[model samples]
Every structure is written in structure tokens, then in C-alpha cells.
Target: MRTLLDLVLPLECAGCGVPGEQWCTGCSRALYVPPVVVRPRVDPGVPCWALGTYSGPRRSGIIALKERGRRSVARPFGRALAEAVGHLRVAGEIDPPELGSLVLVCAPTRARAARARGGDPVLRCARIAAEQLAPETVLVPELLRMSTGVRDSVGLSAGQRQSNVAGRVEVVGVRRSRSDNGGARTGSCTVLLVDDVVTTGATLAESARVLKDFGVPLAGALVVAHA
Candidate 1:
């Protein structure tokens, strides 16, 4: 199924540029380590975990997916997220209620930015992670959204970054857990926020605040990297 363009341009690892593989074994191995608990500048009132610092293969992979449009990298990123969730469950850091589903809510991005980037890479990764953990897990992709006119947080101070996203994140809808047979479940489920990176944790904190206001039960947040 190799196309002519692929044959001419060739496939290169998004993380390390090793030819012939979209994601090389070495780069994929880099993301398989134990998840590290991180304390962000702004706490979201819940445990925050990251795979690693935003460097090396992690940075390259994120850039490839977000800026270069190398969508294939989402598979490895999603698998890493699923593994992290499993680790949290094993360590007792996260516990989904009995007979209820574990919901993965993707941190929202600005619609304009997402449109320019082809789509939301973070949401795509979250969906894949939910699929890998499914039957007991579900994905709520549009549970949150960034309101219009919010500035980017690229070079803002931690406080400034927080101010930028505060009051700008809006919850669109609430999703209740469903059973394996596709029937509605009754008890409360745990909501875990998923994102690509955690810098000052401004966005995550804001997201948790809105979800809390909406009466959603949140367990914690997970990110691919901690900046």
C-alpha cells in the first residue's frame, strides 16, 4: 500500500528520523517508561502524571504530530497514554468506580488553531487511548472547548498563562458512562483529562475547574510530556 509519494519521499521516524519506520523502536521505547508524578506551577487539585520531560524523542514526536502533520505518531503516543493509565490503576493512583466506566476527556484546543492544524491531535490521541482501554473505558472528546479571543500561552509567565485560560474554557456537555453492552450505567465514573503537554498546567487547571463546576468526577490528568 505504499504510494508513489511515499516511495519517493520515504518514511522516516517522527521521533528520531530513522528511515523506513514512522516511529522507530528506540523512540517508542523511550515512551514506555514508568509514568512520573509531576507538580505543576498551578495545581489542578488532582494528581498529574507525565511520561517524561519535553525533550529528546518526546519533543520531536510532538512537533511532528502538531506542526508537521505526521498523524501516524498519534498511535505510539496513544499507546503510551494507555500504558500510563494502566500504571496509575495498578499503583492505586486512579480507581474507577465498580460497574462504571473510566472516561478520558481530551483537553480542548482553540477551534481556529485546530482547524489550521488539520484537526486536534490531542483528541485523536485520546480517542485511540480510549479504544485501547475500551469495554471499561470511554472517550469524551468535546467535553471542553476554548472560547474565542483567548491568547496563546507560548511566552507568558505562569500567572499570565493562567489568566489567559481562566474563564475561557467552557464545558459543552456531560457524558455518562455506558456498560459493555452499550446500555446506560448508573454509578459515578472517574474522569481523566488527557493532553499532549503540561507547561504551567494552566489549561489543565482551568479544564478541571470547569469540569468541577459541571459536577463531573475527576480522578487526575495525564500528559505526554512536562515542559
Candidate 2:
């Protein structure tokens, strides 16, 4: 049975107008045909990897997931992100052990924004991607949280984006255990920050800084698309 929502608004490829598919095979082929490796001008060491540029179906699909309430699209998006991770491995950009040991950390969404969207789209994507990547992989969706009133970075200049998110996000949850001597155990896990898109690299960079305070280092970042 077709879903009422689908019946009301027929499903079509976001990249090309094809009936009954969100992302067709042709677009998927385009997404990773040429691996998109962005040497972050902001932070060189943490090279960014994306499945495709944020245009056409990629951008439309992302917007559908975040703003248009198409949460079902996350499955394909997650698999694509996993594919990007595989690309990193194939290019020798990431070691196998590190990839297995790394935790997936989803970018933080503002409290109000998450409520309005019904849930955290990025976190869902991160969780799904982790599942696709490896069975043993852990996902720390709430590792970071943005401060209230942090404005969305859309349409903002790079400098403006930096200022908007500066001092506005921080680590919230780090598990602590008592040692034999009753001392607290510090965080010792590496994270792979995941986001829907990477533009100015401000958000991922800022997330790395916040995680550093808690003794968690980021191996790199993965995203569905790049701008």
C-alpha cells in the first residue's frame, strides 16, 4: 500500500525527475564517481570527505531530510556516508583500526530547532551511518549540544558563521567510571564528526575544539555532501 503522504505528494528523484525513487542509480553514480576530498582551508589535517557536491539532488535530498520532513531518506544518505568512509579507507586516509575504534558524533542542533523538526536529523543520519559502517561501531549522538539561541548558519558569511557558533557549543556527556582507587576515568575515545554538509568548515572545527576539552580527539569528518 502506498503511504498517504506518498500518495499526496508522489515520490520523485531529487536529482532528476524520476518517479518512485528519492535517489536513482544514475545520481548515486555521480555522487562518488570522483571522490570529493576537500582539503579544509580552515584546518588542513582534518581533510573533509563528501559523497557529492551540495547541489541538484544532493542538496534537495538534504533539505528534504532536515526541513521538509522526509526522514525516510536517511537510509540512503547513511549508506552513502558509509561509502564515503570506505573511500577514505581505500585512499589510505584512514587506518582500519582507527575506523573501527572511532565513535560517530553527530553535529549538534539547537534545542528549539530540534523540537521544531520533531527530532535531530543529523543524529539519526549518524546513527544509521554507524550501523552501516560496522556492527561494533558506537554512536554518541548527544556528545555535543549547542547553546540556546545559536542561529542557523544559512546565508551567513564565513566570518559570521564563526562568530555565530563561537562559544555556543560544548560537550555534554562523557561517561565516567570509578577506578580501583576511586579516581575518575577520563574520556579516551576518538570521534568521527558527522554532519549533513560542510561549507566553511566552522562547525566541524568548532566541534573538534569542544571535544578536545574532554580529551576526545576527532579522526576526521564525514558528510553526505559538500558545498
Candidate 3:
């Protein structure tokens, strides 16, 4: 992991460019805002909650994780994500996610992109969040796979984004919930999609659609930032 790589690399604050801090407390707090629920106009099953807008320290931190290989920031963001998810409540879900019942699924990064980045930072972040939030809750890293030939959604209009990812994500594995201790957990397994950021909500929507088709419908979604 990148954190292991940090033994040689210096730790720097991703948000404010401060020295000797992977992620400053102030910067972390800046990301701890009220979660915004995102539901695209077309699909509603995949409602998502975002910590804040994609700007400021949050944006800088994400960029640092994805591009600069600053893996230290993932822990704080993971903890922040855990807190946000703890407070998130979706319609028809009265109680908090029961232990071992919730599973966090990372939105699939393109295979090409994953190789380019050395690995998936989003998946790493989601794994940490799931561990910190509930060790009983499983984290499924390979649950979703981007359909072949899917292009990057950047700069595309909302409609285009939706169209681009439509039928472009598929479930490639069996949905199962297992604790960190290697024992299978009880309760039905329901997915909660995790992403680094959400803009038009198309990717998450399409992901939810695919998962639902596989009979693993989403409980909801959690993203670090909303653009």
C-alpha cells in the first residue's frame, strides 16, 4: 500500500501543503460537512450521499491520492467517510446498517486506469472506511467491473455521462459478506456503493443498475465529494 511506501517519502498535507502531515485536522474537518444525497433525474434506486462539494481541501486530497500517490490521506478520508455514512439515512431504512449486513462496493475504475494508478485508490479508501466503520461489514473490491470500451466520463454532459456508462458496468462476482476474521456474517448482504466523487451521478446510477440486476440491490451510496 502507499502508506507502506510513505516510510521513505515525506508526509505532506494534501490540502494546505503543510509539512509533516498526511492530512491536517483542519483539512479533515473541512471535509466533514453535511452529506448531500444525489439522485439522478432518471434512476432513483441508487441515491448517494456526499460529504461536501468537490473543491478545497477535499479536492486537493483526492487529487493527491489519485495522481500524486500520497496514500497517507486515505486513512483520514476513510475515517471521515465512516462518520458520514454513520449519519446517513436513506428512505425506507429506519435503523442504521446492522453489523455485517452492510457491504461497501467501490465503483469500478477502468482496468486501464487501475493499472495506470498502480491500483485503485477509491477501493483502498473504501476498504479502510469499511474496516473503521464496522469490521463486521465486508468490503467487496471486485464486485463491479467496468464494461469494455467504456470511455472516461470527464467533460461529458450529464445525459452523455449517463449514456456513456449505460450497460457499461457489470457484476463479475458472487456477492458475499464476510468479516475480517474470515468467518461468514449473517443477515442479508446489501451493497453500498462507494466512490471518491460524484458529479452527475451517472456512474453510480449505472453501477446500481447492474448490481440490482444481479440481485444485490444497493442500500444506498456514499461518496467523499459531490461536484
Name the lDDT of candidate 3.
0.75
lDDT tens digits by residue: candidate 2, 1-227: 23355457888875566887877887676655435777554562465677778888788788877887677667677777777667776787766645346578887778888889868888877777778877656555587899986897889887888788888887776553444321122134445788888888878778878776556666778777778
For each candidate in turn, the TM-score is 0.89, 0.84, 0.84
lDDT of 3 by residue, 1-227 (tens): 55566667677788888888778888988876667776655453756778888898989989988887777778878888777766664434323555336678898778898878778888888878778866565555578888778888788898998888888887776644343322222135556788998878888888888766665657788888888
Estimate the lDDT of model 2.
Answer: 0.72
* Top-scoring candidate (TM-score): 1
Best to worst by lDDT, what's the order?
Answer: 1, 3, 2
Q: Which stretches of model 1 miss by more than 4 angstroms?
A: 1-8, 96-99, 175-187
Which sections of candidate 3 miss by over 4 Å?
1-10, 40-44, 89-94, 175-187
Which of candidates 1 and 3 is the stronger one according to lDDT? Answer: 1
Higher-scoring candidate on TM-score, 1 or 3: 1
Put the candidates in TM-score order, highest first: 1, 2, 3
Per-candidate Cα RMSD to the true structure, in Å, reads 4.1, 3.4, 4.6
